[model samples]
Target: MIRRRTLLGAAALAALATGAFAQDDKTKVGFIYVGPVGDGGWSYEHNQGRLAVEEHFGDKVETVYQESVPEGADAERVMTQMALSGADLIFTTSFGYMDPTMNVAAKFPDVKFEHATGYKTAENVSNYSARFYEGRAVQGLIAGRMTKSNKIGYIASFPIPEVIRGINAAYLAAKKVNPDVEFNVVWAFTWFDPAKEADAAKALIEQGADVVLQHTDSTAPQAAAAEAGNVITFGQASDMGEYAPMPRVSSIIDNWAPYYIDRVQAVMDGTWESKSTWDGIAPGMVEIGEISDAVPADVKAEALALKDAIASGETHPFTGPINKQDGSAWLVEGETADDGTLAGMDFYVEGLSGDIPN
Candidate 1:
């Protein structure tokens, strides 16, 4: 009887140990951010998505992130550390991190990687981005109508296709509504430099641009617009409602939570695969914030109608009759731009002056 009881206790102990190990099998997700999570713009929104993942998974998953990480060698090192530390999946949230992600992914085949705003993929890496140009169209409509000086200022980050597409979309929309509108674009060459962004805004304001738009990730422009007074601005990535009713007339919000959650779930379920995703307003990836009371009621309604049209597929922002910066016809009347053309957009549309910096 003593021998039998001892054997039963040992069996029960083995079962409990197995059960504990199974329960502790948590999925680990990691994120690499280009800017501080408190930037109140792009990185902030991405961090919010990270938080959403935590809320969704509870104890079933563990998430880690390294913010303010620069894009080159530093990014590779950070990713290597994460992979070595047992991260099942990682997200590198910047266009500049594309090559770094690919490099790290090649070394760690079992680790999944997701890169934002880029066009590269591997067996272990996927690319995803929002169609931000769609939202820029709406901002352009408002900027064109609201500008008292008829000179709209554009604070550009890098001259990549994504930023160029935004410039072209905004210019097309503005020129469509206000034929006399002109764009004064300043490429800051940096993504989240508040000082540079502020200087750019002030310079544009000095040059008589009463309306400002930004492709960079910071609220400094809005603040600059506020200090200058009588200038209208729009929020980027996140809804900077703090400056609303005057400088911040409207915004383009990036909703990343749903995508992050879906991808994490895929990794957890062992169904993860490499693919590209480019979502826009139609799928709720891009959102237009409130058109403030500062804008005329008629104009607000018009912008809302345009947003709805874009979301419903009733209108394409890049419809032709558009010309290149050199005055060469690029799009025929009533013709819409193809994804191939848009993805590799490198020239400025006619009516906008200045060359894209290499």
Candidate 2:
């Protein structure tokens, strides 16, 4: 464990970035990104956010990144290394890094730790996540309107709360669009395995799926959609337009730069505090990429309108009559998912077939 004050003073990242940070030397931020910058999806977008930290604050902030670090043991190792390298604030960018982030946080009580998509909290560790599920709901509506097979294929990574929430949101929105729609989920169980993700996409296609969605962190699934012909796809983390351009109907984008910059700036200004954050469209955490022209004009108009309403705090996707997979009521009619249910969403909906083995 390394001291946050020690790291900030010892590291020269901020001093070099701009004179804004050189005035006080208060924050040294380090990020543990879960994927390669070239992966063109989840991890890539996050790294871009890290870059934004340097761009905006200049020398007022310091940012160091460890790319392609897997979420388990590798995550712990990276956190330790970053701590040793003198980091004041550390951001662990994946759900699997929860325990590791906590373990390291315990050793370095002075350093601030922020874990994404993880639900643990500590005196020094706070959790944060983007409402990607909300954006997925929009994608689902489009998928329902576009799909001809009535079968939407989903490429799932792990059955964590984050993944489950997205699946349910997508399903709920699709049901609203077309009640006959059914989602066939193929669990790849790996967050960013390109080959396995591609295989899952192909499997769903072979099983008569016409529209493909993914919770995995690769472009391979979208590529498979293109190869299968006439299948529709959506971007997961970043704009995956390079893959099956025409088939990729739209995307659930991650624009995390603004939040990252704000957090870093706060730390530099000595106003940083530990608090959980679950920012959604209201705060611009959830974003949409360019919709392909292949989609009909009417569908595009509807999607944009829905997106605007959600951003303006006029709508919510989790309003219920919502029930668990067992059909046990979770939320009453008009009741929405507070942060608790969404954070602890560990099961699939009734129509979803796979078991969420705890």
Candidate 3:
């Protein structure tokens, strides 16, 4: 007869071989969102990912999510609840969740955690974010081509690297399109604060901004643009074309459904591994929405062809001779930033007048 210790050893070895350790018999995943699911913006996109998980895993996976969670102690509470709920995988979708996620990671060594827009990793922790700035370059190009005022307004949430990169890319592309074009930025500080975002949009429109772009995730800006008359807007996270026919000129869509499904399936198949993913337009992570009737045909052709080039690895948006916001060189002329540099970007590009808050 096999000794009890011997039997236990055999079981442990088998579990290790399958990539699913003990206590992983039933995989449970938890998602934490920074905004309400009804916000129809950042939180909404994440919730969509959660639904994708359900669709892919069915009954084998137990999934739970808490929305509108603040980035402070509240995040700790939500993570604790997920652990109590017996989660084996948790995805915290917010940059502010970085520290809190790392804190909770130490407490639950067995649980696998994924944090979006954050740069932290442990044996059990990984980071994943889409190259949203790539899409922003496209958005800026469209906005520049469509703007009649030679003035563009950008509605921004925070000064994080992600947001800063977007603003700079948009500004650069728009400048390329119309050298006389100048951009004005309004910082709302809150990711989904519709009222403030709307107000910002109004201010920009009143200031001779004929086109409005947003890094904030809310239709409030679009609504504001619609009411203001003679303004164009873009969608975030989802396509707000229902608001089309008018102000919403185009959109930058987030396609996280397929990736979410594949991750869950990885766990189910006992092949889940920790790694970072920073896919962009090329990998279909950042999708551009339909161009409005307002956009001219030639502009559409140019943008679509550019999209294909980026997706097929023929070009890069952040090509060289780049400068920091301080006018100092960040990359030499004709030098391109590789994946590693872009992934760890902690500086602003040239021509940005604002500061990246600490």
Candidate 4:
């Protein structure tokens, strides 16, 4: 009877040890997206990164995501639930989730948090973003050369620094190539609203804008531009290749998979830390999608040259003799914008009409 009891006790201990080892071997990664995974833009690219994490880690890692999570109270609640469910690391893939991410990080000090396109960080939270402005400079070169009309339009999302930087960089490049070019800006306020994005594109087309650029996360503007017949547009975030060769002459592709894999690896190895990372073309974080044949051969060559210059550090997108919207000198000749100024960019550069909206 004593021998039987000893055998059962040893088996129970082994089972508990195996269970603990299993838990220790696996890491749970979570994601919070501001739009649907099918948006085919920002959220879609982020989701692709999430899938990359799963692919790279396989049985060692599990990923969970909540899509179309609106910023604000809902975001906080969703993040809380993710942390409560044993997520080892969570990525909040939106600028508006900055505050909520901090709040959740404070409550769950053990869980690591990464917020995209945001500056705020805590002991447990890290911020990351791509220098999308580099890609925008290439788009602007294409837009300026391709526009039959001197008028170009921009469909802006929120007035965040990231969006504003894209606008300024594109405008600067366009202005460099076409001195007579003018920008008509329209603020959509929402990041992923298809109807609103389409309406803004239509409005720009009606106003003689032959070239349209958007910071919003939808292909609706491309559709609108396609319907407008003579208009040209560029893809945002992901390549909306369906409209290629015409509406989407070229694109700004956000490549987040490599970075996502690296961060997940760090978490798995217990080496993750709260750090800020802003990568651009040089690191392959921001890719300029193929410029279609619809663009003149010479123009395409020039755009590619500009991309190379930016990547090689031979050119700075925000280099001056640039001015603020009020026509005040912002960067003197031979001067370049610092990371501090660019990260908190709130004003439009000179030649871009209207206010940035509060």
The C-alpha RMSD in Å for every predicted model, in order, reads: 10.8, 5.6, 9.5, 9.8
Query: What TM-score does structure 3 among the candidates reach?
Result: 0.89
Alpha carbon lDDT of each predicted model: 0.91, 0.82, 0.80, 0.90
Report the C-alpha displacement of residue 56, candidate 2, in angstroms.
0.9
User: In every candidate, how many clashes are there?
Assistant: 0, 5, 0, 0
* Error in Å for residue 228 of model 3: 0.8
Question: Residues 202-281, candidate 2, lDDT per residue (tens digit)?
Answer: 99999999999998888998888888899999999888888635678789888889988877776667677878989887
Task: Using TM-score as the measure, name the better of candidate 3 and candidate 4.
Answer: 4
* 1-358: candidate 3 lDDT, tens digit per residue: 2364344434433433443222445677888888888887778888888888887778777677777667766677668657655777899999999999999989998878889988778878888889888888888888888899988998878778788778877887777777888788888898888889999999999999999999887789999988998898888877777778579877888888888877877777868788888889887889988887878899988778777877887767787778887888888877777777776666767765666665
In angstroms, the error of model 2 at 117 is: 1.0
Error of 3 at 270 (Å): 2.6
Write candidate 4's Cα lDDT for 121-215 as tens digits: 89889999999999999999999999888899999999999999999999999999999999998999999999999999999999899999999
RMSD of 3: 9.5
TM-score of 1: 0.93
> If ranked by TM-score, best first, what sequence of candidates would result?
4, 1, 2, 3
Q: Provide the lowest-lDDT 10-residue window in model 2.
A: 14-23
- Tell me each candidate's TM-score: 0.93, 0.90, 0.89, 0.93
* Residue range 1-358, candidate 1, lDDT tens digits: 4564445444433433433333237898888888889998999999999999999999988888877777777678778877777788999999999999999999999999999999989999999999999999999999888887999999999989999999999999999999999999999999999999999999999999999999889899999999999999999999999999889999999999999999999998899999999899999999999999999999999999999999999999999888999989999999999987888899999999888999
lDDT of 1 at 170: 97
